[model samples]
Target: MGLFYSLRGFFRSPGAPPRDAGIQSGQPGGYSSESAAEVTFDSAMQISPVWAAVKLISETIGSMPFNIYEVGPEGRKIATAHPLHRVLTRKPNQYQTDVEFWESMALNLAISGNAYAIIQRLGNEIVGLLPVSSSQVETTLLNDGTVVHAYTTGANVKVYGPQSMWHVKLFGNGIVGLSPLSYARNSIGIAIAADNRVSRVYSNGAKPSGVLTIDKTLTEAQRAQVRASFAGLEAGNDDRLFVLEAGMQYQQISMTPQDIQLLDSRRFQIEDIGRFFGVPSILLNQTFGQSSLGSNVYEILAAFYKLNLRPYLEKFEASVPRWLMEADEAGRYECEFDFDAALLRADLQTRMQANREAINSGQLTPNEARIDEGRPALPGGDKLLIQGAMIPIENAGLKPVQEVPSGTQESEPR
Candidate 1:
């Protein structure tokens, strides 16, 4: 009987050769009658280790669906196979049989920490086989003290960083896709064609060829203050607050009550409100006492009494001694009958009430009611006192605030 076997089965082993019909002789079991009939099978069936190794590798590689080829020196095609060859009736074209596919796959696997290198050839040129090793991986240190490892083959590259799924990708043309490799860490992978001309390096999927920098000039205190400012706390009146002096003539800026509170709280007394307002404490006190309609005692009482001026008068009377006190021609006491004496007495009572209300309401707002505006306006609706001189608020129907000529005089009421 004739025996038939597939090509794959035939290559599985080195077996006995077929017996020729011409060599047959009349024997009990129809044995071959040739002079070489006594030939030992061991000598004929011997196999080389190299061939066995190749066969084993081919068999194992054939199990995979990827196209496989044995590349040799001078770009010789020693062998070629595809996983689908058994199922498909036709074979794949030469393009599928080239070394480019294997080279690309090797690059991808190398970047992924799989096989380090791949060996293949194009036409007759033997591309060197890549050795599997991790020494070629690149490392980088981040500003936050993180170390990263990056892997690259000629065609593909990958990076493993602190973050999850961070990587970059490129093609023969140029950059294509970039993203994280895995969600567990900020790793990234990139791919490119073997013949691609462009070269790029990516970190976390972003090209990083230029200088990287971070400003670290701020002191710890300043940094803390900046952080606090975002949290709604006063960082102190530095340039961080208003840009210009408070009293300088410029565009007016509106402020909410809360804004005012924060401004006052954080303002650097010497640098901010005090210097910019240009009002020294002594000058401020004199201006308030002279131009303000109410007494300092009344100001204190108003805070605690909630806008009532009566308590100030009551406190003033109780604090003064019952004695004849001399007054100057201007009705100002020359004997120092009271300085802030009245204010001091009312302050205790006022502060106590203020504290109580503040505690209950959880509100602590400073008193900023007294502010100097340089000049005061008269009640009649058209006069301003500039250096004790009465000036018209408007000229005719449109009273101009500018100074009139020295020789010019106001028109008499007609």
Candidate 2:
């Protein structure tokens, strides 16, 4: 049976503040963190690595086009005429385009570990979707194992069941998904603290200060004069130079290994953020050894789709039937993202290489390859072709000799 969480006493109640369950963003003490700096969604995004990692993942998955297919006797075919076709491809809601809707949904999922959309209906048919912020929505678990969701923003309050809320959750128990930003507070907080400290140091004075030793003791007035000379050696005094008069010998203070490691730590933090967000270091522009070598870029990219993105695609696909389609219709229809149609193919050379591999391996017909390249099909191109030299290992070196064709000229014995 379909479940519904009735807002028992809220139908006509006067406006009231909703309950606060999750940690709040943008506030210092809201997000629990061991580090000094606050770690909230907004604050974490201020970190460059965090921003890049989130953008890379959400944009890649959200922008990929998806099609609904009808599975039947012949084969799966695009269900273009279905109502979902327009909703998914052209428009997801009245105000937002399909791309915008999915991208925001992906962003929500990346940070909060959950994405919610209210199913806008015209009678019984779903016509549009309205995205709700995961921060403003909270899920409650009843003793009987029934999951209830409450959406609260200011005076507006809404209570709905799973049927009305299209929820995509990250890794967690069935009731609530674990929020990446929430769990990453400590790490992100430390990174933010490091970044801020470095920036502050650079801003105030990053220049190395030197000790100016005078051979003889100076009067109080002489010491003041000397101190005034060195005052101009701070951060913003690039064009100014301190005069080393009165037998003052200058000794330079070079950066120690500990100071150098501080810079290295910042670079490592980029990779740290990428790892947590399921983005490779290379994608975030971090250069490392063999794994990130230039020649292996293609392999890394291919692995990104397979390792990082495939599971995310599956998550979206798995949720479609439960949230978008009727029980009976769900069995007959399937949705798949066009992972290769555009984005992953990337370049003509890569696309051509992939097509060649598919055709040569008999996985695709010549005509199908042509279609993928957006070219006209050639005559007789529909026939599949493969390397005729390939044969079963058991039959290797044991092929029967072919008899000469009739009327064929035999070579003179030589």
Candidate 3:
């Protein structure tokens, strides 16, 4: 808490973690989940599906082409020369690269439904963005209608007004983003409980593989001794021989469908969690059967971006001007995550074909397309060209060049 006292209205990590999550994460307190297991962010990450889903979304979005664009009478173009441009692209602060900083912010957004960073400024000019976690911040709408965030850790609190912080929020009541983890805790608790059941089953070793019974009744002391011995054997004495007293007979327990059902339930829980996060099972590499979306994995991955990712991208783009730029620069500069880069990155064939169509439609000059593809421009490639075959609807059958009438071919052969 006191670590950030040097920076004005700034903090690294503030507030204690959520109840159940704190215990697992080795923090102070904890709460019981719906499934009676502790479902905190730390514990949830231990579950494979949760880890994969959060990582996939965070890394993919964080690494995509996030750019600053300047708007003018002509159109929008990359604002490469802007001061904030270098700050966001190269380094957001002294300790992190652009990718690392955004990835952390994206991770916070994925789990907590909000991401925040302190806007460091020297006088009126902005300097750096110091990232912080959702747990550290609390937001409130003041009576005068301003949103203020208070960062609390233990008893220390640091408050920040709109001008000093950048906030990216997910869908919620417009005051604060709704935390996905809080809402999904029940589902996560079930997964955690299922995992704990397996561990308990093995660790307790009370589930009998075979029972030894005697025709004569055994005394309480004898039964206790028998149970203790068997527990020892079950733990790590698999090769040990069990000597039965009083002509006991050994009976083996047959496998039951309940065991199979337990495994199945665990697998289903993975998909259940995926649905909450808007991540398809295919992305989790758990394609137990055919995907409902389709059998083509590529197509499903494409849909993942459009359906699961596009909203987040748009939210970030829309919030950046308000969050990062100065009020006076609002109309002049904006930010966007290159939607094409997210969807077309690996599909080079599709990218080339799309670029070709763009060029032929006169939407992009040949030189422009070349530059986009990281190739040098040709001398005449700066000009936009359209297909000559395109003709007026009414002149469909007429010769493009009105050929000289048969006799009108100016002295034909001569």
Candidate 4:
């Protein structure tokens, strides 16, 4: 089977606009401009079909905050706040100092092989630097030929490296620990021991033998990749398992009616939010949840969409109508208007024409006007332009607004 078959289930024809496509292009009853702008794919699914699935889900459902649950090695049930949930539930008292400290520590370990470090920001003053080291950073090639760098603190057990940086934390007595090695080996068991400080590692029914610790000096890129991977993991888990149990008490605080009400009141419902906003929602929903104090799935989702998603969609939506109008007037929509292929093609054609004209006008030599496959090739070139001639459209009378000359002003210059 091909990679597409491995990822997506099967290939099907792209569907036409639904008779009652709720909101099309921002208008009611008809497809909203936003909805109309979306393109449905008809091609075979790729190896990672989740990307397309996520895009479709975001476009269809907007963005709602969700909870995530996962079973680590030994069936240890673990639950935490979704990152989206955290944003919605952000409070004035919430601070990033602790998180930042561990993050810095993770980065340092990635680059310098140093694990111990301190993060200081005293109203713009340097404060302290702690001792840390990377006991090991070894690259292991997988069966797929992917080289994975395993960074370990001590013993054969691997400490979370660039992949699991977020879980690294410095608890009481300044002790830091890595997330369990479940990602690498599922049956490899890990148990938080009675001390509440150390994690006991067990593999294949053997007694819990090893301990886990954190690596402090991870690089910014490593930190980002780790964070993104964690987010993806959380999203996968949310869709797959509901690990959290509602009505469960925490620290003697009952999950009561009032608490549920509070959570509902603060949580943001994802119904029609766009895809960009959905990224944060997926992140938060996977990271934080209702159980997260001062932060719930709703609040995190609400804040992210409000703070991030809305503005992005607005800008994107605003640009579409003009492009659509242009395509309509030109009677030549791109292979996929929803994908903005026409606009890309037009832009490419314009640049290529300019370059050709420049060469013709003695502004550049033939050598200077080179054509290379990878060198910013013009979109919808002669071949693609011919291929794009078959776009089907119901109307072609809508004229797009043309750019006016710089001197042609509607009002006096400020």
Candidate 5:
């Protein structure tokens, strides 16, 4: 079920003719035959780099605040106290907390290009949203142009209508979304290959193979005996040490230069995977001694939020109300992913400066600024405050009334 749509029809069913075992001829769409079986969301996760990148994006998004609001007629927005909010915060279902639910949704959307949740409602009110595993799901279209999703695992299959499921897609037509893992298969294959090679080296007692050479020729029986003797030394903890007869030599078979290059290729592959996921390499903790803006965590975080996270937030903000609320109610309600907390998380000095500017510019009341700083508001703080000396630039041309000389008596004309 984790299969890519490219392989959707290539799979076998009982009544269908046997097809090539998930292997397609030629490198169709940049994916080689060798990696067709390994490009699944689950398989991609097996590579450490892929997992790290996916986790970084998913967790960052999951930690963001999801808010529901009511937009009034005059275009004012207010936080809404809806049952869905309680359900999202307390338990989306029996298994997931708000964080866990959103994290899973993000992970699926990142890897498979789709996230699905089964909506459970009591009467007309939705009380829960249970996540369905993306790996176990398939989407199909009907003749009437309706889209249906079927979830199957083992012997069980469940089908859901559009209203019963909350589905979010990334970079796809109205019906189906394309998986990023499919496009990133080649880079992931390189990482997986590198990991496998290193694992094999360690599995063989961390010893490189070598060519055993002798100064003189030996009989077949003698050669067999020599091979057995070497096997005895190389089989166990003694692998680090080797004993040879006089005039016998063991020359280690060093990896060729081309083979050695694959080690460096692994590092580059991490960046490649990051690009496919739209996450900067620096966010993946990859600093290859090059200059990086990530040295300032706040700057990189801001870039990440704007470039990678905002578009996704917009998608959900639009989709949630459309699917979760009644049409009439949807007109009045809005969903938003709040970044205020992140904006307020700047260094103490920067946050203080920002607060000062906002307060002085009349953009925020004293109480509001203090609330953002997590401080108690003082009396009279609710009033908007601006700098006392701040005046209109046009007023600069007007001179204050010429004050009467302090020592002179006021004019009698008064």
Candidate 6:
């Protein structure tokens, strides 16, 4: 009876009519009349801001050191020198370098809300992660509530069970993720249009050739010859001069004021594109003042990490152990991106000051601080140090005051 019910549920049709498909080709959101045209990841890259923002984000995340570590019972972390670490830090596959694999996955996750990597195993041990293009992959729902991934490459279609694929999703239902490109399709389209217009003005010889007025009426042959000559001059014939025997006036037609205004509009459009991607305008090199964040580069970086990068890191942390670790090791093992290097990347003076404070506060040993700064540890550096003046609150003011020496005299008031 249970098997029959499960089979029926698997093959059951939707209770209601399907809504309009979304701007993205395979997304589930209902499309409305006001929906904009489709903007694929490739199409969106045409807009420079979109390209830059995506590159900035993906490359930044990819460049971070990713490691797999074991968590002990007392919350101590021990770095795992496993095969997965080698694959992630060196090369995931033959065709892609470490950075390339990570950047590609990050780009897919940012644009499509899902990043898929095919896990290759040797016997029961996992060996490699091969990237699968998100565009060519689809998720299918089965009757038993099992979801399968279908990856289409050319004429070949390969299906994968959930266990065989490393799937990272953001803002998704259980089956599939909702693409950011689909939601911001209209904004991306507008940015593309603005970019195209700017490119037309800057490239493609968009200048008006000016009006050539002849005082005397000419034959068809004469008119054709005149047009050809004008075309030749406009086609980068810088040394060519127009020889007009008849009465001809060459009135230059310059770009209109409105056409010139497009340069400014393009700049604004770049910011708009950044906004859709959650990138601050300052990061795009735009003229946004840093007054709000008080002009501190460190603060701005902290904000970027927190506001822009933290969520993505959190997602990876949650998913990596579940997907990459053996089930038996799940509770004790995990993966993390080591962000301490980035967070503490500062001038030497600042670093020393911070390190001194940490050591004095008994939070870090002198040797640990030396290790972080890439210096050799000294003898007796392993012990945690606290400032001599930093007594416990209960012992404050408990010591007896000493009397002044006879030879010492207090300075009289000036």
Candidate whose TM-score is highest: 5
TM-score of each: 0.13, 0.73, 0.79, 0.16, 0.81, 0.76
- The full ranking of all candidates by TM-score, starting with the best, is 5, 3, 6, 2, 4, 1
Each model's total of backbone clashes: 21, 0, 3, 51, 0, 1
lDDT (Cα, tens digit) per residue for candidate 1, span 8-27: 23555543332222211111
Better candidate by lDDT, 4 or 6: 6
TM-score of 6: 0.76
lDDT of each: 0.28, 0.75, 0.75, 0.30, 0.73, 0.73
Model 6 RMSD in Å is 8.9
Residue pairs with clashing backbones, model 6 = 10-143
lDDT string, candidate 6, 20-44, tens digits = 2221123533433343334777888
Better of 4 and 6 by TM-score: 6
Write the residue-wise lDDT of candidate 3 on 69-119 in tens digits: 999999999998887888788878999999898798889888988888898
Select the stronger candidate by lDDT from 2 and 5: 2
Clashes of 2: 0
Clashing pairs in 3: 14-136, 20-31, 21-40
lDDT of 1: 0.28
How far is each candidate from the true structure, as Cα RMSD in Å? 47.7, 9.9, 8.6, 31.1, 6.5, 8.9
Residue 20 miss distance in model 4 (angstroms): 44
RMSD of candidate 1 to the truth, in angstroms, is 47.7
Q: Ten residues in a row with the worst lDDT in model 3?
A: 19-28
Ten consecutive residues with minimal summed lDDT in candidate 5? 18-27
